[model samples]
Target: MGYNGPLNNAKYLKACFTKPYKFFIHSVVHTVSHRKGGCDVMKDYQICMVTALVLNKKYNFSIIVFHYMKENITSKSRILVYLRFV
Candidate 1:
């Protein structure tokens, strides 16, 4: 987890973990929504896993490392953090 702040209503669950010297990370993203229908205030959760050259390197580059889908492992988080994966 890098940052945490939400003194009142909801303190989101943000986390980040990595293996030393590894060029990858695992994180969970949560979306908070408020709607006319209270029941529709539910959220959508997604998992994000990425690998890239973000360290001390000559050049910087990032590419889709993996995608996780409930039905197919061939897919990963897209709707929320699609830009990061690209």
Candidate 2:
């Protein structure tokens, strides 16, 4: 038999990876919701936004580089907004 990798739960692994993306989306929604109060919450909100971008750049190897142009694989975080509507 050919070398097959360890037998593991694929669904669970997918859930683990997608969780961060979902959380990122959720935080943005919460920020918009709370933005209407006209309070100083946006400063802290901006910090959270920066932190998410840093995490995506730091941890996601998939988005590190493009296949042909050699440009960084920019994350489509805005796609999360579409997801929220769906």
Candidate 3:
């Protein structure tokens, strides 16, 4: 994704400054979309790696978002994953 406007007018960027999940989903969506190349099936993306360290210590929700990703996009034998909770 390239810049849409001038740096001085980066209101959209500033607006998303506090949203990390959006960025994570954005990057993963791009990578998986690129790898899938127009496929909608979860089993189509066989060579993509998507991992997340979900930490919500305040609510005791420190989980590795692996099963969620797998449930969303199932992979083949080439899917590499290394997820952990800290």
Residue 76, model 1: lDDT of 65
lDDT of 1: 0.26
Q: Of the candidates shown, which would achieve the greatest lDDT relative to the real structure?
A: 3
Q: On residues 9-85, what C-alpha lDDT tens digit does candidate 3 reach at each position?
A: 41233223236545654554444342334322222121123222233223212231445455435666555443322
The worst-scoring run of ten residues by lDDT in candidate 3 lies at 39-48
Q: What shift in Å separates residue 51 of candidate 2 from its native position after superposition?
A: 15
Which order, best to worst by lDDT? 3, 2, 1
Q: Which model scores highest in TM-score?
A: 3
**Which should have the higher lDDT, number 1 or number 3?**
3
lDDT of candidate 3? 0.35
TM-score (C-alpha, index-matched) for candidate 1: 0.16
Q: Write the per-residue lDDT of candidate 2 for residues 1-86, one digit (tens) a residue.
A: 12123324221111222344445444544443322343222333333443567565443323311221232123443222211221
TM-score of 3: 0.22
